[model samples]
Target: MRLIIGGGTLAGKPQLLFIHGIGSARTSDVELREWSTSLANGARAAGHADLVSGLTQSWAAETRFANYSDLFYRADAQGAADGISEEELPLLLALLEEMTQELGHQAELAGDRRSGDIIDSARAQIRAAVEPDAVQGQGLFAVVRRAGNAVTTLLQLPGLRQASQWTSGVQLLPVLSQVGRYLARKEPDDAGQGLDVRIRERVLSGLDPSRPLIVISHSLGTVVAYEALHMYTGRVPLWITLGSPLAMGALVLQRLAPRPPQTPAGVERWLNFWDRDDIVVARPRLERWMEANALGVVPVTARADTHGLWTHTATKYLAHKDVAGPVAETLKNL
Candidate 1:
C-alpha cells in the first residue's frame, strides 16, 4: 500500500514510520496526529494584515510547480499539527481536497493513476509518515514565518531580516547529527558499522529492525538530516528536503566527522533530494553535497513548484511530481 499525494508517496501495509522535528510552541503529539490525517493548518497569523493578493505569488520566480493553484488545492494539514493554531485547520483541509482532484487528473494524463488516487495516496502517506502516538517523522514541506524575528533572514524582511534568533526553538546541529546517523547505516563498512552502533544506542534501541525507514525533511530539518549523515560518514536511504538550510552553521557541522575515503562498515545507504531556488536552500548546494559524494553520499535535486514557499500547501505538487519519483523507486528496490 502507498500514499500518493501529488509527488510524494508513503507505504501503507505495515505502515512506514516518520518523525517531525520540533517547531513552534503550543504544539504536541496529539495535535500532530489529528492534523496529519486532516491535512489542516492552524495559521491565524499568516498574513494578519500583511497578505497582499498580488504578492501572494510572484510569476518571475523560479519554482517547482507551475503556480500556487496547486498549492491551495493541496492544503490539507494531513501531517503534524504541533505548531498550527485552532482557527487554521479547517481552511487547510479544504485546500487539500481541491488540490487532490486537480493533481489526480494531471497525474492520470501523465500515466500515474485516476483522480481518486490522489486522495488514496495522500491518505496512505499521512498515516505511514506519522505514528498513531508519535505524530510523524520529517515531511516534504515546512513553514517558517517570523513576523518580526530572525527567521526571515533568508528573504528580505524589515526587522525580521536582520534580527538574530529570538525563539528558543529547536537548534540545527543536534537535529542534523541525529538524522545523519539513521542514513549512515545504509552503507556497509567500518565507519558505517561503528556509526550504526552509536545510532542503535541512541535511536534504534526500540525500533523494529526490519521496519523500513523513510526520512522526509524540510528547511532546518534538511540540515539536520545532512549533518547526521556527515557526522556518521554518510549512509541513508530516501533523504528528501524542501527549503533546507544546508549552509547554516549547525546544519553544516564543520569537520565534526572524519574525511572521506575512510568510511567505516555497516552504514545505511542514501538518496539526498532537495529543491532549487528554495530561498532557504538555494545555490551552492551542488558544491556542498559534492564533497560528501566521495564518502558515498548520493544526492538528488527536486525542483520546487513555487519560489520560497516551504509549506505543504505550496509544495505538494512538486512532492508528488518531482520529489516522490526517486523516493518511491528507491523504497521499492529496498
Candidate 2:
C-alpha cells in the first residue's frame, strides 16, 4: 500500500499524514487517494477554497498517509484475507478481564455496585457469545466482531438504554475491549517485535523533520500516532485526531507509550473531533482530560448506522465541514 497521499512526488511542501484505525489493513492505495481528494472537495464545497488550494496546488502538493495496518497483521501473521490470528485470542481474553476489573473499580468508587455486577455478568457471557460461532468454524476475529456488534445492538434497546447512566466508554467497552488489549500489550524494544513500534516506524519513514507536518489520525491510529509523535524527533505543528479513544482513562490513557501527556512533544496545536454517538470514543472532548494543553475538542453529528460503530468512519469525518475546515486552515497557515 502507498504511504504517501499527495502529489506523485515528495520533494517539498508540508506533509499531511493520515493514520487509519482497526479493520483497515486491507484499504488500498487508490482508496486513500480518493479520500484525500474527497477532503479537498468537501473543503471547497464548504467555502474553504483557499485552504483546499494548499492541497491541490501543483507546486506544493502535500498530503501523505501512514498505512500501518499491515504491520499489525504482519506482527500476528494474520493477513487481511484471513481474519485475526489465533495468538490474538489470549490477548483479547486477557484484555476483556482487565477491562471488566477496571470498570468494576470505577463502579465501586461511584458506589454503584449494581453496575459492577452487571459488568461482571456481561463479562461472563462473552465466551458463550462467541463459542457457538467458533465451534461452527468461524474465525476468532469474526466471533469477537459479532460479540462486539451484539453489545452495540443491545445498548440501543429501549429498556437497556434506560437501565443505567453508563458512560460512553464503559458502555462501549465490550465492543472496544480487544482494541484496548492491542494497545496495552507489552511492547518489545525492537521495532519489529511489536505492532506499535512497527506502526511508528512506518509513520516516520518519510517524515522530513525540516518541513511542516500535520498528522490526522482516526480511531486506534490516534494511539499509534500519539506514541509516534512522542518518539519522533521532528516538528508536528498540528495533530488532528478523529473518533479517538485516548481519553478513556484507565483503558487507554495509562497504556500509551510515554504515557498520555498534556500534549505530545513538538505539537503546537491538538484538535480532536468526535461524534457524540460514536461509542469507540467514549469521551468526546479531550481537552478536559488533557487540560490546559491547547487542545480543541470539536463535536460533529454523525449518523449511527444500524451497526452503530460505523459512525467512526473516516470518510464521514472527512466529509464534514468541521473536520475539513480545520484541515484547510492548517494547510493554509503552513
Candidate 3:
C-alpha cells in the first residue's frame, strides 16, 4: 500500500513483499502502513539502528503489499458483508468434519476411547459453529461472536488436544483441514482463487524479478508464496513466514510444488516465526520434516490481545526481534 517507487536506485537492495493470509478482507491500507512502520520501529527496538536508517534512506519505498484478500473474499461473498458467508460455512464445516472424522478414526484404530470421545466433542463444536442460528449476522460483532463460539468449543476438547500432543500424526489433522479447505474451495473460473496458480500469480505480479527478494507472508499467504517460488524462476534471498501452517506434515508438505524439497528453490534462507499459542501454526520446526540448515523456526511469545486465535495476527508477529532480526540480516547482506 505504501509504494514509494522510482527514487534514486539502491542497487542490490532486496525488495520486501508482504502477503496477507485469510480473514483479511477487511484489512485497510492504514493497517498495512502501520505494519511497515512497526517493522521499522521493531528494527530499532532490536538494536539494528544502522539497518533501520539504511533501509529507510535507501529503500523505504521498495516495500510492497501483495494484498489478495478482496479477491479471496469475492469468491465467497454470499453472506453478510462483515461475516463469513453462508456458502463458506459449509466448506468450513466440511473441513472441520473431516478433521474430526480423521481424528476419531485414528483414535479408534489406536483403541483410545478417551480420544474418540474428544473427537466426538470436537465434531459437535464444529457443528455448533455452523448451525443455522449459531452466528447472528448482525455485523462484525456477530462474526467475532461466531469465531468465539467455535474457538471455545474446540478449546474444551481436552481429549483431542491431549491425543494430538501424544500422537505423532494427530496434531496435523486440524492444520491439514484448514489447508485442505483453502486448496479445495471452488471459485468462479474468472475469480482466480486457486493457491498454486491464481493466488500465486497475484503474488508474483507485484514482484520485480531482478531485485533480491525478502518475502514476508502470514498464514495461508505462506502457502501461496511457497508455490509461487516453485513456479517462478527468480531468486528470493530471504523467505520469512509468520504463523505458517506449511509444517503440518504430509497433507500439506507432500502436495507442495517442487514437491517439498529440503529448502524451497531460489530461496537462500528461510525464517519461520510461530507463536506457540497461535492455532494456525500446528508445527514450526519445518526443518525437522524437510531438509536442514536453511530453515529455522523462531518461537515468539503470543500476545493475548483478545480472545480466540487472534494470536496469529500479523501485528504481533511483526513486533518481535526474531522477525526483525531476519529482515535486518537481509538488509545487512544488501
Give candidate 3 regions above 4 Å deviation: 1-6, 26-28, 53-61, 75-148, 154-181, 191-196, 292-309
lDDT of 2: 0.59
Tens digits of per-residue lDDT for model 1, 67-132:
111111223435423333223322222222333333344445556554235335553433332333
In candidate 2, list every pair of residues with a backbone clash: 5-64
Assess every candidate by TM-score.
0.38, 0.66, 0.66
**lDDT, candidates in the order shown:** 0.32, 0.59, 0.59
Q: Model 3 — TM-score against the truth? A: 0.66
Candidate maximizing lDDT: 2
lDDT of 2 by residue, 118-161 (tens): 66565665556446447258765565554454454435432244
Clash list (residue pairs), candidate 3: none
Candidate 1: list runs displaced more than 4 Å: 1-22, 26-205, 210-212, 227-236, 249-277, 282-295, 307-318
Candidate 3 lDDT, 1-334, residue by residue in tens: 1323457564554688888876534454665676676677668867876556544443543677786665543434444323444444444455445445654665577687875676577667566656666555444335334443444444444322333232322223333233554565455355554534666667788577777778888888888787777666667777888877676555456656666445665787777777644545555656566553244322222322222234556767776766776687666665
Winner by lDDT between candidate 3 and candidate 1 = 3
Error of 1 at 304 (Å): 2.2
Q: Which regions of candidate 2 fall more than 4 Å away from where they truly are?
A: 1-12, 50-61, 74-149, 152-178, 185-192, 291-309
